[model samples]
Target chain A: MTQTNQPEINVQEKRPLDTGTAESTSSEPRFSPQVDIWENDRGLTVVADMPGVNADGLSIDLNDNVLTIHGRIEAQNPGKKVLTQEFEVGDYYRQFKLSEDIDKEAIAATIKDGVLAVSLPKMAPAQPRKITVVQA
Target chain B: MAFLPFFGRNFSGSFWELEKMRSHMDHVYNALADGFNQIRRNYTGVFPLVNISEDEDNLFLTAELPGLTADRLEISIKGETLTLKGAKTQDNAGDETLNYHRRERQAGSFSRSLTLPVKVKSEDVGAVFKNGILTVTLPKATEARAHQITVQAQ
Candidate 1:
């Protein structure tokens, strides 16, 4: 699996996603959510930090070899005057490319406390196998 | 030892001097790097970015803290200052044998204190944690609240 080129500065602060090439129709701004990806013998795991996003506001899709994750944040405070604003509220969007060795049908995702975890299991044939030798 | 002219008895002494100089430079470089890293961390700005809003009666403070539960957060108010403290634990990805492709999230303890514009009733403060967002409501003190005065026809 591989991800597109993302700048290193994105790790520090939330940045608005580039909408020049994307087909985003919503007027609400979208921010790229921070994620951590790791691979083990079983499969690959992706953990994302998406604060203010509930279970009903998250969506994950896989088309062809591209996997996309989108999260929406509902308006928390409405009609209240903002006194000191340090961060902006927006939705989250990110995408990743998957390899053929992964079992696309077996992918699963779970969310808790606004954090999302996606598990992509590897195909059986892609797993490493050990063979025992017998003396003839 | 006789192959080169500089490989005489002074070789060991000069070699020690060179080694000491190299070690000194190494220490200086490490210190400089540490200072840069410190500045970078701070330049990235504060953790759990907060937004404070207010109405006529109450002031609301909200912060985004993902992967944290209510028990991990502590909020306290003293005079006009409100303090928030919390620690975020790292997730367990089974074992250490896994190969990391990308890592961006951070886990550590954070403490932030902000002074409210107006004094609030400490005893009546309320806080709620939902969807990794923390919202604290502080009601304005009686004396600090705006009081509308009635005008009688003179």
Candidate 2:
């Protein structure tokens, strides 16, 4: 198992301080999609469960050390009357703060079955180097 | 719209509060995720979250089910209620020896029954699942369809 000096992935339903142009159709509350973060020798991987989110409706941004994931959920039918609603449906918002160890430019992401997976590669200089034993 | 997580600690004590909320939400989500197996801990309310809407002739019910396939799900309509039952199995790539840093996504069986507002023809009902969202369209019965009344002005 590869060792990671990073802390646990903290996910929350909060918007970044610098809000971008992400418009929602409804006034319903936006929930934070549950996510799982794991690290290996190569880099870190983040998997998020975002049901009802389409590829066109998902957006990811990395500004400075802050990384944000946004997803917009469409209504079942446009201009239809809702009879019953168990859980509110709205946009999905979450963010993470990246350290200097991560290579922001090398980040890649893909969404399948409404699950978003992001790969954040670590910088070469930040990776651990094996030290060889020498006779002193 | 609230406190930022895993970012610069802009406000003191707010991170902890948000963490609490996140855990609480996770608990609820996990409970729903585990409700299908009947062996879930912290299982409380409903399982699959749903949204029911009605148009002129059909009623649409949409369910949020991530990573679920047709074989794992079962849908039935009994009288005025529509029941949704299914299970989600974790795909571990046959490697249980691998260590997991954080395991939040869950797998379990869940059954949820919802009562329809109006009568629907079971034979004419249509369902489609796309992108992890299951949408069931139930056409209204002949008597349940809307009747328009026209007024004649003098």
How much lDDT does each candidate structure score? 0.84, 0.76
| Alpha-carbon runs more than 4 Å astray in model 1 | A1-11, A20-27, A126-136, B1-45
Candidate 2 lDDT, tens digit per residue, A4-61? 3322221122222233586555556777777777777778788888888989999999
DockQ of 2: 0.21
- Quote the lDDT for A38 in model 1: 92
Give lDDT tens digits, candidate 1, residues B62-137. Answer: 8888888998888989999988877776666456888989888877677777789999999999999988889999
Name the runs in model 2 displaced over 4 angstroms. A1-28, A124-136, B1-44, B91-101, B149-154
Looking only at chain A, give the TM-score of model 2 against the true structure: 0.68
Q: Which candidate is the best by lDDT?
A: 1
Global Cα lDDT for candidate 2: 0.76
| TM-scores for the candidates | 0.76, 0.66
Q: Considering just chain B, what TM-score does every model have? A: 0.70, 0.67
